[model samples]
Target: MFKDITPNQLFDLKQSKMTIVDVRSPKEFQDATIPGAINMPLFSDEERSVIGTIYKLEGQEAAKDLGLKICAKKLPEYIEAFKQLPQPLTVFCWRGGMRSKTVATVLDLMNIHVTKLSGGIKAYRNWIKEQLDTLPLPELFVLNGCTGSGKTHMLHTLEKEGYPVIELERMASHRGSIFGHIGRKPLNQRTFDLVLGEALLTLKNAPYIVIEGESSRIGKIKIPDRFYQHKEASHQYVIALPIAQRIELILAEYQPEIHHDQFIEAFSIIKRRIHTPVAHRIDEALKNHNYREAIRDLLDYYYDPRYRHTLNYNEEQMTTFKVTSIEDALAKLRAILPALHVF
Candidate 1:
């Protein structure tokens, strides 16, 4: 059912110009799959649904008959699609099931040198699950501090210096909080995974990496569990600054025009948990130019309370380190990430 390529061999071929095909239906392909995989479904969503219903209501034999009919119809179209990628080709479906095997077998007969994923998409997803679960989390050094601490500004500074810093919230089109979304379309999940894959690829041999402290879900996208908990449990570093500097940082992050009722739409996600007094205070502050009061009050009533509740009750024990000044943060970081200081 497979080319008998070793994991390394298949993986090696996967790196460059190779054709990876997903034989699952369009809906499944849209949900998630390996990068660069083209959708050449052996069954469309409705076709698969009908076949499944027959299997449940009639019998396995009847379902197989229905599946064969769908496959025969699409077989030629499927072949044509693979023509676009002339290089080594591979095919996979949910469980290395009949659909993938059939397509793979057809291509193999044509002398395409095709490989079928051993366990199929199930295996790849399982691999992600395992890495997210058991792989000792990456060494996650965080850029943490209060609002004006310029944590994000520092991330850019570090990036310019050549350090690998993950601007996760920025990529997610969210600020990693309730009022995070500014309505731009977040990156598609496929692109998101591609970026994440690249980041993970870069960190493979590193001792540690610096990332911003973020909640599990940024806007609507959730971080993989393994990385989140790893950072949560790892040594934490705080990027600190004076109050005046922090205020400036705050203003820079959330702009004046953005302070209007439109944020209410985003914050609506947490309305149930928002206290009545806090809501009233926010409304009043929004009406007046009491932006400082509005922001601080929200932090005290909503943000601070929630963060405290999480930090205090969470089972993952974390060690704290402070970034007293930009120079100090850079100095401490330089010791661990020497190449980062080059910029």
Candidate 2:
């Protein structure tokens, strides 16, 4: 028998010093998991599948015998890993079931001082969903700007200066654009929520949060309606950069992630809007590695035209700053902080 703690208890304990171990299969761990928990699977993906088949075809007793045999062989490795882990570790599995119990039992016997999560990761996920829906969010301030104005860069700079900022793109692993997935592996919606919730939780007590203005969807993930509603109503500041400078900034930021195929494909998407002839030229330029020209044409003909309406829509309420470079952007941002009172 092993001790088990409720999800609430686990959530509270997370604030303190402790290591959380996830004992689910690797695939499950990768799709979504507790933010800080490490994956220490009791069964590899293939082994879990094999055990599942045995349980379905044979029976529980047969599966148990098989599992025990497999565990016996790997026990030495597991023990060695546990020996190096910080003490007072917490362990969990998909449903606070046998997998986690089996591992926790071993650690306990080794005098590692372990606690098992009651109802497991599933319960923790439920708690996360509830928190996302009901947790009181700090005042959210939107940082609005034309494409490639370096808003994301400014957000990171502000965070480094002790300002409360949340980089949504980083959390979602997508850049919040048509090209968002170019070089990034987008997280599934469940994983997005897990990380977003974790980010929000950390900022719960901040005076306010600075975030980029983005549509509801970022890659495959959808911003929760509640959070999106807050974003819609929050005060916003716009950063302005000259078209040439914007193009240069965009190219520099995406340079490492640029692939000819992907760049051509992205331009193809705007073919119907900007027309095939123009899109064709851009595509050809990208294929030839003329990135600066391609980016310039896309910004001028595609992104700029599409985003122009924002400048006029709420002209009176929005604060706009014209910045020519990163240093200029920071200075302008600092000028607005007094108004935001975040200092």
Candidate 3:
């Protein structure tokens, strides 16, 4: 007989060498799932929909008959696929429902014992939310900077050098700006939470975690209240780069020439916030392919002032570093890492 495991037990099992097989349809798996769980869908989207329709109109018996017929043809393939996976497998579906039950029962009968998640993905999601709500996390070492200051780059470098770091912007697939979504597709809240929970789990015992400072919201995703609270209370490193270097970094990252249409669209959304003449100049520069001038005008008149006005921390509360390049910035940060006891 197969075992049924609760969400908490399954979470602990994640650290062990095991594969989590998601038996939901492809679309459901794609929408949001436990991080690192692989899809082994029990039914195609259309097939699942047909089964649901049958259940609604013709009742349970008819739906089970249809499901059985569908499964019969696919059983051989299922067995072959499960055999190829590593042992000590865990299986789940939407709500520990039919899909996972059928797969688990069949696999058990075949003597390929696999555990079923007690409440499936729904239970896992609830467990994740509960953890995020109540679990204490490591203290944050927030890197604060203006729009083009390469704070994200710093987080990546720190992570590479063995410091515990979380790249929230990267996770969200956004830069947390008006032009943030130009070249990337942002993750929805559910997906963002899934990854965030995974990251928190990985870094729960670190001395402290490094992260770029961000507002509570990044694009369509909101940072969890627990993390946001820690961020607000953390010591901040405010990085300052010369305007020329900042512009170069922004140009390299956004590559307006390659994303010209996206840039144009983003500008249209924020034009009303800029002074009419300045916005006009920016529009003209983009039209003429003068990205440098456009970017400069935006920093001087738009982004810089807005950033200053929204500043949450005073200078006394921050450790400021004015550097000439990213290399210089990294070196400075390295010098202070020991002082922070983050080693």
Candidate achieving the largest TM-score: 3
Indicate which candidate wins on lDDT: 3
> In candidate 3, what are the lDDT values of residues 1-343, reduced to their tens digit?
8999998888789889678999999999888888789999889999999999999999999999999999999999988999999988999998998989999999999999699999988888888888888778877878888889999888888887788889999999998998999889888888888788878876777778889989999988899988897898888898989999999999999999999988898999999999999999999999889999999999999998987776678666689898999999889988877444343
Model 3 segments more than 4 A misplaced: 338-343
* TM-score ranking of the models: 3, 2, 1
lDDT of each: 0.68, 0.82, 0.89
Q: Which of the predicted structures, 1 or 3, would earn the higher lDDT when compared with the native?
A: 3
TM-score of each: 0.70, 0.92, 0.93
Extract clashing residue pairs from model 2: none
lDDT of 2 by residue, 232-253 (tens): 7777787788878788778777
lDDT of 3: 0.89
Q: After superposition, how far is residue 336 of candidate 3 from its true place, in Å?
A: 2.4
Report the lDDT tens digits of candidate 1 across residue range 142-197.
Answer: 76554455667768778777676778876666676666656455655544544465
